[model samples]
Target chain A: MRLAVTGAGAVGRSVVELAGEYGHEVVAVADSSSAVVADAGLDPEALVTRKAEAGVVGDGDPGDALAADYDVLVEATPTTLGDAEPGFSHVRTALERDRHAVLANKGPVAERYADLRALARDGDGDVRFEATVGGAIPAISTVEDVEPGHVTAVRGVLNGTANFILTRMAAEGLDYDHVLAEAQDLGVAEADPSFDVDGTDAALKCVILANVLSFGAADDPADAREFTLDDADVEGIRDVPGSALRLAAEDGRTVRLIGEATGGTVRVAPRLVPENGTLAVSGTQNIVQIETSHAGRLNISGLGAGGPETASAVLSDVGRLG
Target chain B: MSDAPDGAPEDPEGADEADPAVDGGHDPGSSTHTVRLELVDEPGQLLAALQPIADNGGNLLSIYHERGNKTPRGRIPVEVDFEATADRFEVIVGALRDEGIAVMQAGTERYAEELTLLLVGHLIDTDLSDTLSRIEADASTSVADVSLAAPQGTAEASSARLRLEARTGETADALETVRGIAEEKGLRVVAPLAGVET
Candidate 1:
């Protein structure tokens, strides 16, 4: 597959490297300010090195890479909340051109799955975003094994940063602020971290899962009826104190930032998880539990963050296209 | 069991009988055991259910998985005939349960041993799901059935009847896993002095 990546961050670089390792050609690459295009295929390692050293991937702008020729547009750009801009428009552009778009950016999928799928249906293009939900966990593909309508619900600890904060507070008996500081120091939580600690990240990922499950009112760019982030009742771990964790622990349970979706409804809250239960996955790791009507409940857990992890999912999506 | 055919033992009565040597998949203690299983009607269901059997020393003889007929549970009814020794049969059934593959019936062998106990505590409030999961996660046990009694409501207190199936001598190990969960949850465990309850 010939590829063009939008984000020149860690995930985008990993995708390019893995694509090259898997023998796929990276026809174009871009960062926030620079875009590179090579009809004969760019050297992935060299391109990544250039981005790191020069703070730019190439001489051109992001629009050049978006307009560049490629079989699949790999959108790993940073997520935007409201309109889900650049990422949303890039995917729309790819589909409009009858080309495939594999996404790692959660904004577009959480905000526009209906519109994207509707567009893909009208054209020769299609979309796959396994990396959007649970990072490297095969949340979408594993559930795909069951017949479409058979999956009753999908639930999981989707946000690594939120989960890390919660788990640390629970285990160390520390308050949210202390744990947040620790997580920030460990590089698990970003400096601002509002998007993650405020439940927006998990809500977006849950909405994406809802959309992938075709929750009917699945989330969309238009913020459709059923599964929009607006409709989701999200409660972040910010207010959950270490005292709450101690109380739950006394009862042989722990609190985890759980995201849930059954049909049109999607929510993210601190749900009680068994200390040893399958959903009790901790730290920066992520886990997803899918309840299928037939095949029973299936749980998938693994590294849910990192460039290679997300890229691993992106490459798998690309492979599915092939 | 068939006696090895000696040169002088080619009797007239054995003319139409099946030759043990020609049974194709025959081994010394191997017997064709008919095991019934209920599986989900989905792709890879049969393979997932059958892999454990093969892994635990059961050789595939035939699969009578009926797609048209489902069990009362609405799952596909699959009847499998396989060749395995008596001891191998015990391991096979346990493995099936470990894989979460429903072994509806495995010939005359049903997990070799069963242990049931009474757990009294706040099952729901203290997270009964976690308690049950920990026991099930132990390789030695699987929760065959559970009965919870919370007449006073979930807040007050509750007791559950857990039917656990263990490998032949692993009943003690299964009981230990149960005991561990009980101790951790501040729950009381009641063990019957009688032989065993079905």
Candidate 2:
């Protein structure tokens, strides 16, 4: 399959760099400002180097690459909130033209899911977003395999930055500010870190999962309920002091920012889990726990974020489309 | 036993000395007893009847007080379930009778289930004892144990871990009781994942 990639970020560059090894060709690539389009396959090294040194992928208009001939459009742009624009528009263009859209952006799926579903239904192409939930863990696909109707609930430690901060605080007996600073220095958490710690990021991911479960289980798509960030009951770890963790630890337990999504609701909060439990993943790691009817509880754990880690999920999504 | 009156059971010994073994030989370690009493439909009558059970080291399990259901004498019927040693069970019954409360029946019963959670906030300022008393007074729930950590001082934010033993199948009601208290006090509660034992 031929791929047209957008947003020259870490994930986009990694997808372009690794597409060849996966037996796929990158026909067009675009960043915010420029685009490089070729009827034949473009050179991965040249495009990445141009993006590095020249700060642009090519001289063509970014819209030109959207019009380029490709089988799948990979939307790896930074996620935006309401409307989820540029990324949503990019996906819409691909589906409108009967081309598949694989997304690494959470905004489109988390915010505008019904719109994307409507487009996918009308067009001949399919839509799959395995990367939007858990980076390298096969969370979305596993839920799909179990068949959403049979699954009771999907929950996990979805945010690595929040988990890292909590883990360090419990281990070192430090306050939230002190451990968050250490996490920022180690690059485990962003400098701003509001989205990760304030529970918005985790809530968004759980909202996406709730959308999948709700829509997937419904017999008719129109009758299914759609979830957005506003529907979630979210609580962050910012107010969780060291004393809380200490109190929890004394009873062989610890606090983690756990996000849960069922067909009807979405909630994220600091919950007390056993000290060495499966959901108590240490450091920058993630775990997805699925409760199903036929099959018992299933747990999937791995790196939740990174360039190649997330890009791998995108490429596998493409492979699934074929 | 079938022909006995509501407030009085037919037995050789007095109501307080009813045999635990005769009610079906339950485990010897501890046994639960259901004691039915008649109240005068007064304000402190229910509390007056329950004070003896708690004062005599009985683990109160549940209290089914139907205000609308009254005896022919205009007295209210209240059934209380509690767990205690065989000797303490006798002592509690004696205490209730000594308080001028009628004892309808005392027989073996069973109660089981426990929930653990954490509360985070200015617990000292909010009157931790009052918070606990309110929880105990709300439902058939009792705070089995509590561990408080006020490392930063009593004025700052603190945390408390509470282990509650509730009647079987009443976990949801017990949690709701705690959540209501926490919300009113402006505190945060970290509850365990329900039905998922880690």
Against the true structure, what is every candidate's RMSD? Answer: 16.8, 10.1
Q: What local distance difference test score does each model get?
A: 0.77, 0.88
Which residue runs does candidate 2 get wrong by more than 4 Å? B1-111
Off by over 4 Å in 1: A215-226, B1-198
- For each candidate, give its TM-score against the true structure: 0.61, 0.82
Residues A149-176, candidate 2: write the lDDT tens digits: 9999999999999999999999999999
**Which has the greatest lDDT?**
2
Docking class of 1: incorrect
Highest DockQ against the true fold, candidate: 2
lDDT per residue, candidate 2, B1-198, as tens digits? Answer: 453333332344444654553463354534557877768888999999999998887778789998899854467889998767778887987798678676655553322566889999999999999999999786667675678999978867899998776766887899899999999999988888888765
Error of 1 at A321 (Å): 0.4
How much is the lDDT of residue A234 in candidate 1? 83
